[model samples]
Target: MRFAWKVFLSGILVTVIALSLTAYWLTQAAFGTALSQEKQKALDRMRMLSVVVESMAAEYSFSSEEAELAGVMRSAATGDFSSAALFSKDRRALYGRAGESAPMEELFEGAAAGLCHVILARDGGYDMHMLMPVQLGVATGYLYLAADVSAPFALSDEMTRTASLITCAAAVAAGAALVVVARLLTAPVRALSAVARAFSKGDYAGRAEVRCADEIGELTRDFNAMADSLEGHMRELAQQARRREDFVASFAHELKTPLTSIIGYADTLRSRALDEEERFRSANYIFTEGRRLERLSLKLLELMVLDRRDFPLRDILTGDVRERLTDALEAVLRGKYGVTLACALPEAAVRSEADLLQTMLVNLIDNAAKASKEGQTVTLTGRCCPAGYRMDVADEGAGIPEKELSRVREAFYMVDKSRSRARDGAGLGLALCDAIAGVIGTELHIESEQGRGTTVWFLLPYGEGEADAQ
Candidate 1:
């Protein structure tokens, strides 16, 4: 059964049982008291009748004939009495016919000694027989009186029936109230069940309404919280799936461009004899595309490693990081790219995985170098801030548009595709940097204008007790 019905039925059963027992007990007790009173009234009447017979026997002489004594007995047998009889000292019935087939000898003997009474069940009712000794002149007689005392028993039966009716009525009334109460109590549970069903059917927004400050309400709240968490995780999983799809498509496009160029150039060199200049040009094209392919493969490998592995952070001095970046960037940016590399860093210990941090910094500085023109400077600055050791890479190149800044970290997503391709950029540098920043428990914050410049910065927490490092 449903929970509400179970509760209702259980309550009804309890109410019926309790009311039944109470009514039964009350009816029995009242019946017993009334029956006792009826019995006492019957005995009293018997005694009064015996007194009247004794008075007559004393006033008149009844010892001469038995018919005279029987006449007195018949007169006394009036209102409640069913029958009356008289017995001599020898146990002879001298009055009305005896009603019950009892041992008269024993009754006469008991009467001679003292007044006695006995109640017997007869004809689905009760009868009380009283025996008393009456003195008649010089001799003594026994008066036997039988009275119908069945009215109390009849009343008791009627009371029992009435009690049963009351109990049933009470049970029905209580059952109705319990039905309402049970439904009210379980309403939240039903709502929660409905919400759960809807959620299972992919309606993540469904929620239970809490209507009371009970355990069921708390359960509803907890279920809503769990649903929220699950919905968030589902959305996150969907986004990850979309990202993987984009990454795959971008990866294929990057590979096709380089591989197609290399293959075409190689086929031309192999199929046809060309002049020295044309041959050199074809070979250089093949070599350049080959190099680009190699770079793309290395960046993809790094991204895969970052996704699959966990890196442990260690204490590294900011001065050492600055020196490494200068060595890695100064020669390439100045000689080849015609960009000056500038570093202004303090001596401080920051917690970071050394290789991942170096990779991130190199990518950022290289991107900055590529963005700048000859004599334009790419600045790498580090300082001790309240949050951590802060590092910024700023370039005064034609800055990224504000709209494009958000998507620049996506793999193979470049603001100027042709310009990026001319500089051998596969658009994976900022993507790799973003991944490295996540490994170091941080994120890149990039600020850019349409034409002014772009600044990319991130924070690394200070080493243990090394916040004051200088």
Candidate 2:
């Protein structure tokens, strides 16, 4: 069943059982008390009559005393008393009502030593029979009084009916009140269930809004937290899937461009005889496109190898890093690209594979050179710190926009696609750098402002000899 109904019915059932038992006990106890009180009243009247009889017997003979007692008892008869009788010790009727007396010995045999009483029910009316031993100086007899108890019985029955009605009414009221209380108690649970259903229907943003200082409130808080975590993870997975799709599409397009050019030109060179100048131009174009394809293939291979290969790290000084970066940038600078580079290096040993570190730095510096204008200096800066050695490649180039910075590290994602394509950039430079940084336990941090410049930096873990070098 639903939680609210379970709580409501459980509370109502408990109240009904407890109330039923209480009503039954109280009604029976009240009935018993009323019956006892009526019996006591009958006993008291019988004793009073015995006193009057003994007083008369003190001044008269046995027969005369008996006769006078009968007359007195008949005169004393009221609606409550139905009959009165006197019996001898030997079990014979002496006076009072005719055909109603019984053997005294048999009546008193099972009774106690003193006065005794019993309630006799007949024709829906109750009669209390009270037996007492009578004494007049030297004579002894038994007095029996039968008092009609139908009035007390009727009162008791009326009370029972009234109590039953009250009990039933109270039960209904208690059930209603308990239902309200159960609803109030289970409100938080129901809210949580609703949110859970919404979540099942793919609404990850739905949350329970119960707020209190109880276990239910704690559960609500935990459920909301779980929903938030699930939503965040799903968003990350979706973004990753989109990025993968974009990377495949871009990589295929890049490959197809060079292949189409190479195929078309080779077919021309094979199909027709051309002038020497035209022939050299087609051959040079073919070779140039072929070189670009080679470069793209090599970069892709390097990225795959770095991802799968676990290289052992060793300490390499910052001076060595500067030398490697200079050597890698030498060819690009020599062809009158007019990109000047300035180096500011501090002496420190960084803990990393020398080759991977060199690749990361070369990609960064090459990217900076490509982004810079002729004669706009690129600075290679380094410093030693407590935690590691830091390097920054700052370029006086058109800076990337803030919104595109976060996505620039993704493979085949470019801030300026046309410009990167003109420079033979496959847009895998930063992706390579980022993978290298992760393998070496670091992160690539990029900061740039539009129209000013871009700075790419990261920290390498300090080697054992780094402190001495610093």
Candidate 3:
């Protein structure tokens, strides 16, 4: 059903079939070969006996050496045969030994005239014999020699059993090897299929493991490339949507502050009995909101411009880190929140951009100030790190939630919607901070918990300032 299943099954099926066919054919061939060799050897044994017996007959007829001939025949039997015989040209047994004596004519009875290896009885030994008539046309009695074939047959039987065992073992080993090859072949496919399923379920971060440099690896490379393209496109769309929403919210917040003050001023001026002090206060409120709106607009425009630029860092300088941090904090922390701002800056200079470093630190401190209670403390500390300088701004008020900390730095992203609007703030501080940090090559570090207050800071490469130069 699934692609991985198909791959696994296909591999296993091919291996099993191949092993089975090979074992069957090899076993058949081995059996045939062994049988042929055994049969040939049996025939050769019969032939060898023909030569031995013919010589014995010659000795008996030429030298009257019947005793020696019988002794030689008995020795050749190896105790596995009971009888061997030589008959004269008159169809009379010349030398007969079959456990007892018989008339020469009576014993020379059989009509077999060629070499033959015969299994004597159901429970006895085999006999390899050669019978040759001495004369051609008038063929009379011949020489007969016999030897047992039981040991050779037994040996052949043992070899056949051993061969069967070896074949079985080879088949088993082949099957195991096939299984291993099948699993190896199917592994990459299985990994890719799993990743594909994960991607289907909306996890674009899914990845497939590369197992080999074969076709499967090529396939995985293509699939991962496709996934990367899709993920980038999706992220682009999400970013565009968020930007649109942020623009609308920032505009509305900025407009509302000034419009509220303008409306108040208009109400006061319209009243017939308004005093001079009340008139001036109402007019001042209108101007104040307008100035706030102006500041919000300028900040937003600057952020937009910075966002389009590819700000790669160069022309770095070493400066007094403490002075830069204090200047930024003092400028930004002028609001009415009653919080102690603590700074622990090192009297050390490092390579960085001064203005960008100051801006980033100011924004982080400002964010912490907003999150702090009236009597809480916001502490700013600068320390030297392995790669660069570390700045920390920790607060003692309401902290951000564990999940929503990542989105807080987004333009117009307010964790507390109602409170943020009531404060007449445009929610651009963190966004501006993030942009400035990027321009100067630093990372914004934000940590938060529900009621434990929020901490936001930026670590920058420290650099030269006017104080350090002096």
Candidate 4:
């Protein structure tokens, strides 16, 4: 059966058994007490009658054979007796009701008391039979009395029927009440079960309502917590799936662009009769595209490797960061882009993989220089914090729009696709920097406003060697 019904039926069974037993005991006790009291009252009346009979005998001499004896006995008998008789010592009935006889032989043969009381069954009813031996000086005989007890017994039977009916009604009410209570108790559990089923079927929005301060309430709370966690994990998984799909499509497109350029130019160099300048230009174009492909391949390999495991770290100072940024800027943009460098380096040291850190810095500075107008200053700043060294690379160029900032670190995503392609950008600079930063225990934070500028920053844990040196 269902849980509520099971509990209801069990409660009902216990109530029925308990109340029935109690009712039976109480009714029996009441009936027995009343019957005993009635019997005692009957005996008391019989004793009083014996005393009257003795007085009558003392006043007048009487014989069992005399008719006057019956008169005396009838005069002494009270109206409570259903039948009255005087039995001689020899067991002969001298006086009684018209047709009734006292069963003296069966009742008094081995009896010990001068007053004998017994219950006799007749015509499906009961009679209280009392026999009292009477003594009148030298004469002795038995006075017999019978009182109907069927009414009292009938009353007891009626009480039992009434008690049974009342108990049944009470049991039903208690059972129904218990069923409602059981339903109320299990309601939260039922709601939780439904929520779990819905969540399992991919409907994560369902939640359990916790309305009590009991174990069930605690369970409801725990269920909601687990559902929240599962929903979050599902969302993360979906985002990761979409990221992988976008990465594949972007990678294919990025690869196709350069390969197509190299192939087209190589075909021209091979199939066309060209002058020295035309042939040389086509070959150089192929070489330049080939070199761009090489850079993309190398960055892709680095990102894949960074994702797979932890990298070793070493002590490096913020001064070292400044020097590296200067050398890389001079090598890539010193005389080419007219990009000016500005530095604010502190005497702070950090723990990091030096090569990965340099590559991350190089990518950030290169992107910054590429974004800047000629004669615009690209600022590189580093300082010590309580936990580590923090660094910023900011460019005075067209800033990324706020909406596109979140995806700028995703592979092959660029804010200005055409500008990036024109500048020979493969759109992997920030993605590579982000991957490297993660490996080195940092996050790349990008902040920008359109028509203003963009700044990228991160922090590195303080090195143990630096701590000891300080």
Who wins the lDDT comparison? 1
Clashes of each: 0, 0, 9, 0
User: Global CA lDDT of candidate 1, please?
Assistant: 0.78
Top candidate on TM-score is 1
lDDT of 2 at 238: 75
What lDDT does each candidate get?
0.78, 0.73, 0.60, 0.75
Q: Candidate 3, 467: how far from true, in Å?
A: 34
The sequence of per-residue lDDT tens digits that candidate 1 reaches over residues 378-456 is 9989888888888999999899987887899988788888877877787887886787688788889999876667899
Worst 10 residues of 3 by lDDT: 98-107
Indicate the residue-level lDDT of 410 in model 4.
78
| RMSD, every candidate, angstroms | 9.4, 9.5, 13.7, 9.0
Candidate 2, 307-333: lDDT as tens digits: 334556788888877864654455345
Per-candidate TM equals 0.57, 0.56, 0.38, 0.56
Q: Which stretches of candidate 2 lie over 4 Å from their true place?
A: 18-29, 58-82, 97-106, 136-139, 175-183, 265-470
Q: lDDT winner between 3 and 4, please give it.
A: 4
Q: In model 3, what are the clashing residue pairs, if there are any?
A: 318-463, 318-464, 319-463, 319-464, 319-465, 350-462, 398-453, 399-453, 399-454
Q: Against the correct fold, how does model 1 do in TM-score?
A: 0.57
Ranking by lDDT: 1, 4, 2, 3
lDDT of 4 at 432: 68
